[model samples]
Target chain A: MSGPARTPAEPATAPALEARELEVRFPAGRGRWARAVDGVSLAVRPGQVVALVGESGCGKSTLARALLGLQPVHAGQVLVDGAPLAASRAGLKAYRRRAQLVLQDPMGSLNPRMSVYESVAEGLRIHGVGDEERRVAEALGRVGLRPPERFFARYPHELSGGQRQRVVIAGALVLEPSILVADEPVSSLDASVRGEILALLLRLREELGLSLLVVTHDLGLAWNIADRIAVMYLGRIIEEGSTDEVLGEPKHPYTRALLSVVPEVGRLEPVVLTGEPPDPAAIPAGCRFHPRCPLLRSGLPDEVVTRCHGRALPVLPVQGPHRAACHATDRASADS
Target chain B: MGPGARYALRSVASGLGTLLFVVVFNFFLFRMLPGDPIGLYTRGRNVPPEQIEALRAELDRPLLEQFVTYLANPFASTINSARYNQPVWTLIGDRVWATLLLVGTAIVLASILGTWIGIRAGWRRGERFDRVSTGVTLTLYSMPEFWLGMILLITFGVGVGFVPGVFPIGGIITPGVDPTSLAGVLDVMWHMVLPVTTLMVVYLAEYALVMRASLIDELGEDYLTVARAKGLMDKVVRRRHAVPNALLPTVTLILLNLGFVVSGAITVETVFSWPGLGLLSYDALRGPDIALLQAIFLLFSIGVIVANIIADLLYAVLDPRVRA
Candidate 1:
C-alpha cells in the first residue's frame, strides 16, 4: 500500500518540533555547575522518526522531557509547530494533548488501579472525544487488542506485558496526537514480546502519520525503528546521523567503540580510550572524551588521531546529512 | 470470605481484643481508687449500727453482684435511678438514636471538610494555599473541643443574641419536654449545634492534617504522575486517586474516634450541658453506679466494634484492589 494520503489538510510546512541552542544544567558543589544538555539543538519533523541513542546516563531522556515540556529548558527556545511553548498554560496543555509520552517500562507504566478501558480512554476523556466507549474500542482494536470487549473491562493486572504496552499506546493515540515521545518504550519488556510491540509502534506511526522521538540505549532496537539516529554520551549528543551512515561507518571514537561491541551478546570488551567519560560534575576541559580517547589507548596511540586529541570535535558531515562528533580516522580498519 | 472481608475481620478482632484488655485493666484500676464506692454512697454522717449494716449490705451486695453479672453478660439490664422503675436498657434504647443522629451528622461533616481541606493542602504542597489550610487545621486541631464549643456558643449564642440560648445551651432537652416529640427533637439539635460544631471542627482538623500527609505521599507516586500526564486536572486527580488512597489510613483513626464520640466528649457535653452519651458516661463515673458504668463500658465497646466494621466495609468499597 502507498503511504498516508495527503489531504488539503496537510500543512504547507512539516516542521513538527524545533530546538535551538538548548541547554539544561544542575547546581554542582559550591556554585559550580554540571551541564546536562549544553548548546544541543535538534529537530523532530512531522512523520519522521528521530531515535535518540545513548548509553544509560546520557541526556536523551532529558531532551525528551524538555521537548515534551516535562522538564523545562534552561537556556533555549522550544518550538512546537512554529509556536514558542512558554507562553500559554492552556496552549501548552493543548500542545501536550498533541504530544504524548509512552514510558519505558511496559509493566509499570499503566496504573494497576485503572482498567484497560480507563487507561486507554484516558486521553479520549481528556480531549472530550465523543462516544468515549466506541472510541476506546476503536483505539484498542487499532492497537491489535482484538475483541476489544474482552479487554476493555479488564484491569492492567489481567493483561499480559505486550497488552499493557499497547494500552499505553492506545491511550496516547486515542487523543490523535501528532507527536509521540516513546522514552525507552520496550526496554523493559521480555525479548520475545519486544518485537511485536516494536512492530505495533511502527504500524501506528505509519497509519496515524505520527512523528516519533524514540529514545533507546539499544542500537539494535533503533536499527529497524528510526529513519535517523542521534547517539549521546555523558549527557551530550556526541554523534548523530542517518542510521545507516552512523552505524555503517561510525565517526565518534565512542560511537566506533560502541558499534564495535554491539555484535556480541553482553560482551564487555577492553578497548582503547584516553580515559573513561569525564565526570559530569568535573567535565574535563577541552574535549569531554579526551581522557577516554582510544587514541590514547596506550600512551596516546600516535598523533595519528585526527579528532578527540583534546578539543571539542566538530559535527562533521560525512555524506547526506550524516554526522559524527569525531575527526578521528576509522583506526580499526586502518590498523588492519 | 472475600479478601477485604477477611482483612476486615482480622482488624475488627484485633480492635475488640484491645478494647477487652483495656476494659479489664480500667475496671481493676477503678477498684484501686482511694474511696470505696459503697462508702461514698453511704455519705459522711454515722447512723445506728443496724442501719449502717443494712445500708452496707444493700449497696455492697448489689455492687459485687453487678460486677460479677457484667463479667458473665455484658448486655445484662440494670435499673435506671434517673427514671424510677425503668431499666437501663430502656434508657439506652431510647437515647441511642439521639446520640447517633448527633455524632453521625458531626462525623459526616468532619469527613467531608477534613478530606477536602486535606486534599487541597496535599495537592500543591508547600504552596501558600497549602500553608493556609495547614494553618487552619493546626489552629483548629489544637483548640480544645470544649473550648471550641464555648467559643461557638459565645459567638452565635451570646454575642449575636439571635440564637441567645434559643438552642439548648446544655442538657439533651429542656425540663418537662418529651425527648421523643418534635419539640424535644428541636431542643436536641439546638443543644447539638454547639457540640457538633465544636466536635466537627476539632475532629475535622486532625483528620485533614492526617489526610494532607497521606495525599502528599500519594502525589509522589509514579501512578499519580501517569494520571497527571493523562491530563487529569489537579482536583480530579486528587479526588479520584490521591484522596481515596490517602483516606485509607485515616479510616481506622476515625473508626477508633467513633468510640470516643459515643463514650463521651465529656468536656463539650458538660460545656453545653447536653444530655448525650458523654454526659451519661461522666455522670455514671461520678455516681459509682455500677450498673450504669458497666453498661456504658459495654456500649462503648460495641460502638467501637461497629464503627471499625463499617470502616472495613467502606475501605473495601473505595479500593477495589483490596477486595480483589
Candidate 2:
C-alpha cells in the first residue's frame, strides 16, 4: 500500500545547494598542487535526496566540509539557497542558518555532558526559533523517542548507540534547516540500526521538504533512499544519473565495478574489486581508472589506444539520462 | 571495606612506610655528624650528674626503639627537646599552620590566574594574543624562583625602600606584634606578597602552557565540530564545549604540580630569608636540628600524599565522563 499515494512534497523554487566548477588542491611538499576535488559540479533540489558514493579518499568529506564553509575551496563558489556561501560576513551567517550537517560518528559527536533535551534545544536557541519547550518536545517526538519524557533529561552516556544517533538527527532537525549535508551519517552505525536512521531521514525529508546530500560508501543507501546518484573516484565524478540507471545499467567501468560489489539481500559473496582504489593525491594522468579498468582491451586495436592513451576520452549516455566518463564506454557504444 | 575506605587505607599505608624510612635514616645520619644534640644541649657547659644522665638516657635509646615509640604515639605524650627543654610536637604545631596558609594561598592564586590565561590563548588559537601568551609563559616558567625572589628583594626591599628590610620578607608576622591582633594579621599578609608572587610567576607559566596544549588538542574533537555545524555562534561552540573538555587533563596536572611547589617553594623562602617551612628546612639542612629536620620531612611527605589523593577525587566532580 502506498498509503494514499501521498505526493512527495513540492521542492523549493531555487536549488537547495549548488556548486559551480568546484576545485580544491593542496600545495605539495615539492611545490606542485595536488588536486582534491577537481572540477566537481553538483546540484541538489529541495526535498530530493542525492547520494554521493565513493571510496574513502574521493574528496567526499572535503566536498561536504566546503558545503558548510568548514573548508576553504581554491577555485569556485558554493551557493546555498541562491546566495554565495563566502561572499561576506552576513552571507556566511545566513548560509549557516540554512545548511546543517549530520556527522558520521554519533558516539563521538554527542557531548557526554549534554542531555538529550539540551542537545536538541541547542540548535533552536542558536537560530532563535520558536518556544524552546515545544520545539524540543516536537523534535524528540519525530525522532521516535517514545514517551519523550523518559529520554529528555538523560545524558548521552546513558543512551544506547542507536538512541545516541537519533538524538544527533534530532539536533540537526530542530533548526528547521533547508538542506542537511549528512556526511557519512550512518557509516558508524550497526547494520540493524542503519536502516532505522535512513528511514527516519527519508520521512523527515518528505514531511519537512528538506534537501539531503548523503555522502556514503554504501550502494544500499543510494538504492534505498536516493532519487539521484553521483559516483566519484580519485576526487572526480565518473558517473551520474537516476538511482535505477546507475544500479541496473552502470555506464562507466568504475561505476560498473562499484555496483558489482553490492551484497544482495539473499545472495552471498559480494563481488570484490581486483585492487584498492588509486591514491587521490597521485591519480593516474590519463583516464585515472585505466590501471584497474577491466574492459581496457589490453590489446587495443591501435586506433582506440591512440585515442584513449593519446588525448581524448569520450562521454557516453546510458539508461535514463546516465552520463559516463570514459573512452571505453564510447568505443562500446560504437561497437554496439 | 568500601571502595573509598580501601583507597584511603592504601594511601595511609604508603605514608607510614615513607615516614619510617625518613625518621630512621635522619636519626642515625644526623647523630653521626660532628656534634650531637646532647652536646648542643649542654653547649659545652658543665652540668650536674643527674641532668647529664637524664639527657644521655634520652639520647641512648636505639634509633628503631625511638622510631617505634614515635609511631605508636604520634599524638600520645610527646618527647621534649633536651636542647630547648620544650615539647618537640609543640614547636612543630606552632610552625606548620603558618607555612600551610602562606604556601596554600600562593598555589591557589597561581592555578586560577594560569588557567584563565591558558584558556583565553587556546580559544583564540593562532592570534597575536596567543603568541604573547606563549612568550610570557615560557619566559616566566624558566626563571628560577629564588632569583626572582632576590630581584624582588633588591627592588622592593632595598632600592625603593617600600619595606624596611629582608629578614621579615614574605613571612608570618613582624617580631613585636601579637599574632592575635588584626595588625599582626595584616603584617603577615604584607610579608606574604614577595613569596607568593615569586612562586606564583614561577609556576603559573607551566600551568598555562600545559593547559594550552590540552585545550588545543580538545578543540579538534568531533563534538565541537558538530556543535559548530548546529548553526551556533563560534563563541558558544568554543566556550561551552571546548573549554570544559580541555580543562579535564589540566586538573590532574594542577594537582601534581601543587605538591611539587609546596615542597619545591624552598628556594623563594631561602632567598627572602622568610621564617616558613622552606627556610626552616634549609636551616635544618645546615646542622644542630636533626629532630626538626625529621619533623619537616615527615610533614612534606604527608602534604604530597594528601595532594595526590585530592587530585584523584577531583576527577569525578570535574568531568562527567569520568563519573560514568
- Report per-prediction Cα RMSD to one decimal: 7.0, 5.7
Return the lDDT, model 1, position B97. 63
The candidate maximizing TM-score is 2
The candidate scoring highest on lDDT is: 2
List model 1 lDDT by residue over A1-336, tens digit each.
122232222235736886666787787879987777776667677787778887776677778878877676788778887777854667767887888888887656666567889888777777677899898888899999999999977877677788888888888888888998898989888889898888888788789988888999888777667777788776667776776677766777787777666763234463544445555667665456666777445444354444344455442221126555543553332332
Docking class of 2: medium
Please provide TM-scores, in order, for all candidate models, with all chains considered together.
0.73, 0.80
Looking at model 1 chain B, which ten-residue stretch has the lowest summed lDDT?
A: B77-86
DockQ of each: 0.26, 0.53
Cα deviation at B280, candidate 1, in Å, is: 3.2
